[model samples]
Target chain A: QKEVEQDPGPLSVPEGAIVSLNCTYSNSAFQYFMWYRQYSRKGPELLMYTYSSGNKEDGRFTAQVDKSSKYISLFIRDSQPSDSATYLCAMRGNSGTYKYIFGTGTRLKVLA
Target chain B: EPEVTQTPSHQVTQMGQEVILRCVPISNHLYFYWYRQILGQKVEFLVSFYNNEISEKSEIFDDQFSVERPDGSNFTLKIRSTKLEDSAMYFCASREVGTGANEQYFGPGTRLTVT
Candidate 1:
């Protein structure tokens, strides 16, 4: 099985709607979870970061990790057209190295 | 806020030719990394550098690939002999410290096309 799996969603939602993106992983050692936003032809930018399980909120975005289920999620509240982009979920083990494993990413569109 | 910067936003080269992608990480960052994303594929880690040496590298990082911190500010990834499969977007990332908890900042990336 792939170490990390994410729906390659071209998920479209209306402006002001709530958007939830998720990823599942097989590695139980992964301790740090991150969400990145990437526009077409642009680099991935850090959107939200969380360590271990629980919920982390930053502005309109919230990141949740369920280590027991090996699942992670990023939720965008009050989505806007400016929020349209591919969301990539990345994770790394607790080792003191920066090696990261990434999901295929989900494409999201927030319609105006 | 400091950000990583990559140069030659796009590059096209002939197969078997050597190509080097350059990046300037955040000045205070102590860890550097290289990752690549092939067309329609997930981003994959290539290698990580800290304390002037490789901390870890994925299997995809073969002997043909090499990374260097040639100067105080610049980090580079060199593909000795490019293959068509080498065509992908290469990203440079850096973190303030070599810790699993620190957030990494990524550069825009360099799109390499090996024909």
Candidate 2:
């Protein structure tokens, strides 16, 4: 089984809607959770990062991690057309190696 | 604001040829990394370097691939003999230390098209 799994969602939503993207993992040793945004032909850029299990808020984006359930989520409030992109979730074990395991990104399109 | 920067936004090379992708990580950053993304695929980690040595590498980072911090500021990834599968976007990343945080800043990436 893949260590990290995410729905490759070509999800489309209208503007001003609340968007929730999620990923589930099969490993319990993962302690660092991160969300990245990637545009077409560009590299993945770090959006939000959380250590262990907790809720982290950064303006329009909120990242939550549940280590017990091995689940992580990113919520976007008031989604906009400019927010359309692929969101990838990545995590690494607490071993401090910093080698990340990434999920298959979900594509999102917020239409105006 | 400092950010990771990569050169040669796009490269097209023949198979079996050697190619070197260069990156200038943020000043004062202690950790550097190389990741790649194939067409319509997830970004995969290749290797991580710290203190002038490889800290970790994935299986895909085999004998053909090598990374070096040739200078205090420049980090590079050299593919000894490029394969058809080597066509992908190579991204460079760097993270600062001593802040009790490890969030990497990625470059725009160099699209390597192996012909």
Candidate 3:
């Protein structure tokens, strides 16, 4: 299985809708979990990052990690048109090598 | 609000030619990395450099690929002989520390087109 798996969602939602993006990791050793937002033809911008097995909130975004189930999620509250982009989930092991394993990003479009 | 910067926003190179992509990471950051994302694919790690050496690299970072810290400010990736498959978006990232607590900042990226 791939180290990280994310649904390649071309999900469309109306403005102000709640958006939930998820990823499943096969490696139990992964400790650093991150969410990145990428625009078309642009680089992935780091959104939220967490190393624990709980939820972390930063403004309108929340990142949750469940080590036991190896599941991670990013929640966007009150989404807007500007939130239209590809959401990528990335992680790395604690081995200190610092190479990130990334999932195939989910493309999201928030319409007016 | 210092961020990583890469040179030549877009590059078009012929196959079998050598192309060097350049990046200047955040001045205070300690770890540097090179990653490539093929069109419609996941971003794949190419190599990581710390303490002026390659800390780790992936299988895709083969003999055709090499990375160097030419100076205190610049970290570069050189493709010895470009192949058609080398066309992609190359990103440079840097982290303040090895621990997972810190976030790795990324550059805008250089779009490479190997024709």
State the lDDT of candidate 1 residue by residue for A10-91, as single tens digits.
9999999999999999999998999999998788999988999999999999999999999999999999999999999999
Q: How do the predictions measure up, each by TM-score?
A: 0.97, 0.97, 0.98
What digit string (tens of lDDT, one per residue) describes model 2 on residues A1-112? 8899999999999999999999999989898999999999887889999999999999999999998899999999999999999999999886765778899999999999
Stretches of candidate 1 exceeding 4 Å from the true structure: B98-101
Q: A10, model 3: CA deviation in Å?
A: 0.1
Q: Give model 3's docking category.
A: high
Report the C-alpha displacement of residue A47, candidate 3, in angstroms: 0.6
What DockQ would candidate 1 receive versus the native complex?
0.89
Q: Lowest-scoring 10 consecutive residues by lDDT in candidate 3 chain B? A: B95-104
Assign candidate 1 its CAPRI class.
high
Checking candidate 2 for backbone clashes, the offending pairs are none
Interface RMSD of 1: 0.8
How big is the positional error of residue B2 in model 2, measured in Å on the Cα after superposition?
0.8
* lDDT tens digits by residue: candidate 3, A1-112: 9889999989999999999999999999898899999999988899988986999999999999999999999999999999999999999887766789999999999999
Candidate 1 residue-wise lDDT, B20-95, digit = tens: 9999999988899999999888889999999899998989999999999999999999999999999999999998
Where is model 1 chain A poorest over a 10-residue stretch in terms of lDDT?
A92-101
Across B60-113, the per-residue lDDT of candidate 3 in tens digits comes to 999999999988899999999999999999999998974443688899999999
Model 2 vs. true fold: TM: 0.97
RMSD of 1: 1.1
